[model samples]
Target: MVEGIFHVGEALAAGDVAYLVQAPETLISPFGRDLVAAAEANGTPVYPVSAAVMGAIADKDNPQGLLAVAHTRHVALNSLGPASQPWLVALVAPQDPGNVGSILRAIDAVGASGLLLLDGGVDVYHPAAIRAAMGATFHRPVVAASFAEFAGWARAGGYRVYGTSAHGRADYRAAGYTPPLILLMGSERQGLTAEQTALCDELLRLPMRGRATSLNLAMATGIFLYAIHDALDQQGYFAARAS
Candidate 1:
């Protein structure tokens, strides 16, 4: 369970809340009280606890006076964005929860279609990932699939798969980002393997000019996110995500 008020609020807005725990501190805060009222309206049970008890139950170091538990929404590969402009970010076996969360934030920031977690990686709902993601976790379509499943789906969907790698020959800026594509980011410890990279239609690389050989996973993904948006906007191919 997570303790941030806004996070819980987002959960409530999405009708994803199972329940909520309220501490005395929230009684005095306007938004906190609003959430409790919203919870009641939604028929979600609310449990009141002392701050000490809240601290004991919450995962955050400093509890936000509210804790919300919501069922995870398992988005399917076929149910992702529109086939015409299905720009997606796929992370392969990402080990860091914080990185996954930050990448989700980046996805929301750039208005990308969705995120796909391939193979096994940090859960999209891990507390750390949720905390790091703020409330963006509840806003996007997140799916989990095996690498093979994803590859097959991409082919069937006519997607252009672009893998990101340090050794990739094509510069990220120069590469074409046609719609219905996947930007696959490999694990932080071990980037895309040769075989994995081979699955992509092309491999994209960011420039390395400084002593630092690589950029952090979230940072690289953000750079790419913006670049794709800029390119699409310039080409008049950009559209606000369809509801």
Candidate 2:
């Protein structure tokens, strides 16, 4: 039995453990009572805690009085499974949990195979990051490795690494995104380091015309991913006919 496993009615109904507080009403506003009762009927344990105790661990500002402490799921980095091409996304030197989570979500949305986080990047399991991911962290494959290890592996695997930068001349839209590609994104304030930046086959940037000097890290990552998807789509990624 997990010590911190709390069960809210809906989470239980959904066959998942949930942490519940004294006022079930607060937790069920979105889920409703019928769903809560069904969860309880389905053998989902609802462990209620005092408001003070719950407040201590819950995200107070937006706590739904519901949470679940469960084992973290792990996904290996190398095996992206069957696809027209393999794509790896690297979160390098990112400190913000939200940005990391958002990047993970974008990676999943674009159906990227693997996610690699540099040593100095934000913790993938951080609560804030998990929330920002909107549950994508659970499904996305990820690995943590040093730049040297990744460079060696990428080289051996024939992966073309494209690093995102403010100084790069190549526009991402114009760049070719072939199979076995590694897309590297950097920190919010400082971009990639000299060593990491040097490892990339090409450096690319998003075109910007607004007053802001550049785009947000998450937005930039999404743009690059969508651009790749577009490129692949144009090349008849899943068409029955051969290109």
Candidates' lDDT values, in order?
0.84, 0.68
- Model 2 per-residue lDDT tens digits across residues 1-243: 111112233224334344333336455455544444554576555566655665676764545555655445454444433343378788877788888889888887877776788766687778777776766665666688777777777777778889988788799889988767889887677788898898889999877787888787888888999998788778776353343
Lowest lDDT sum, 10 consecutive residues, model 2, at 1-10
Q: How well does candidate 1 match the true structure in TM-score terms?
A: 0.93
Task: Please give the clash total of every predicted structure, in order.
Answer: 0, 5
What is the TM-score of each predicted model, taking all chains together?
A: 0.93, 0.78
Candidate 2 has an lDDT of: 0.68
* Pairs with steric clashes in candidate 1: none
Model 1 scores worst on lDDT over the 10 consecutive residues at 234-243
Return the top candidate by lDDT. 1
Residue pairs with clashing backbones, model 2 = 6-18, 6-19, 7-18, 8-18, 13-39
Give the C-alpha lDDT of model 1.
0.84
List the candidate 2 regions with Cα displacement exceeding 4 Å.
1-25, 30-45, 74-85, 238-243
